[model samples]
Target: MHELSIVMSIIDIAETHARNASSSAIEEVELDIGELSGVEMASFDFAWQQATKQTLLEGARRQVNRIPGKAVCLDCSASFPIRQLYDPCPVCGNHLLDIVSGKELRVRSLIVV
Candidate 1:
């Protein structure tokens, strides 16, 4: 699955940073996953476990912070929460909206020791 590749990439990044920082090990990896990031959390977690099976991050914890979907209505100039990408604005019921969040998947922090 793609989550395996994603987890491998995360491990690579964490390893690089840990080595650069002269840390003995990685304690945790923090990720910001938006609602519309198209990633499966369970699959990601499983992939992470498999990816770090024999690495220094074998015991490292992954802390995922979920970011909610948000849309800014272009018609009403109002912002509201959305559960889907195509969801209309709650305030104005407008389909003309610019998505402001919930489409990102990024590493926010790394805890090494």
Candidate 2:
């Protein structure tokens, strides 16, 4: 699955950073995953468990912050929370929207020791 590749990338990044800092282990990892990022949480969890073995992040605590989807209606200038990518504006019911947030997938912080 693609989640396994994602997890492997994360492990590679964390391990690279830890090695650069002269740390033997990573204590914690903070990630910002948006609701619209298309990552299945259950699959990601399983991938993480499998990918982190024998790595610096094997014992690291993972903290994932789920960012809610938000968008602004272009026609009505109304802002609203969305659960999906193609959701229409709540106020104007318009299809044209400008995404304000909730498309992020990044490593926010890492605690190495």
Candidate 3:
């Protein structure tokens, strides 16, 4: 799964930060993953379990914040919640949308010690 690669990248980032901070281990990690970010949560969890072995983040507590999708109708300038990609604007039934949120995939914070 692509989540494995994502997890690997996260580990790289965490390691870089921990090394820069002169920390021996990462205690916690917080992530923000939005619904529209194309990540499968179940697959991500499995990948995380497999990827963290023998690393600084091996024992780190992880927290994920799920961000709900939101978009604005380009035609009507109306904003509404979206459940999936390419969802039409609820107010105008238009496909022309400007995504306002819910495409996030990032490491929000890390606690190293």
Candidate 4:
């Protein structure tokens, strides 16, 4: 699954940073996986459990912030919260929207030691 690859990438990044800082282990990791980011948290958690074995991120504290989806309607300039990518604007009922957030998938921070 793609989640496995994603977890591997995260481990790689964390390890690289740790090594760059002259550290051998990561203590914590913070991530922002938005609602519209298309990552399945269940699958990601499972992959993380398997992928972090013997790695720098093993036993690292992981904090995930679930960001809510938000968009601005192009037709009426109304901003609204969305649950899905195809959600139409509630105020103007317009399909055209400029997504302001909730598409993020990134490692926000890492604590290495």
Give the best candidate by TM-score: 3
What are the per-model numbers of colliding residue pairs?
0, 0, 0, 0
lDDT of 4 by residue, 1-113 (tens): 79899899898888888898999788899999999988999999999999999999999999999999999999999999999888999987889999999998899999887
Which candidate leads in lDDT? 3
lDDT of 3 by residue, 3-60 (tens): 9999999999999999999999999999999999999999999999999999998979
Cα deviation at 55, candidate 4, in Å, is 0.6
lDDT of 2: 0.90
Pairs in clash, predicted candidate 1? none
Residue 79, model 2: lDDT of 91
- Number of clashing residue pairs, candidate 3: 0
Candidate 3, residue 103: lDDT? 94
TM-scores for all candidates: the values are: 0.89, 0.96, 0.97, 0.96
Task: In candidate 4, list every pair of residues with a backbone clash.
Answer: none
- What local lDDT does model 3 show for residue 82? 95
**Each prediction's Cα RMSD?**
1.4, 0.8, 0.7, 0.8
For candidate 1, what is the lDDT?
A: 0.85
In candidate 3, which residue pairs get closer than 3 Å at backbone N, Cα or C atoms, i.e. clash? none
lDDT of 3: 0.93
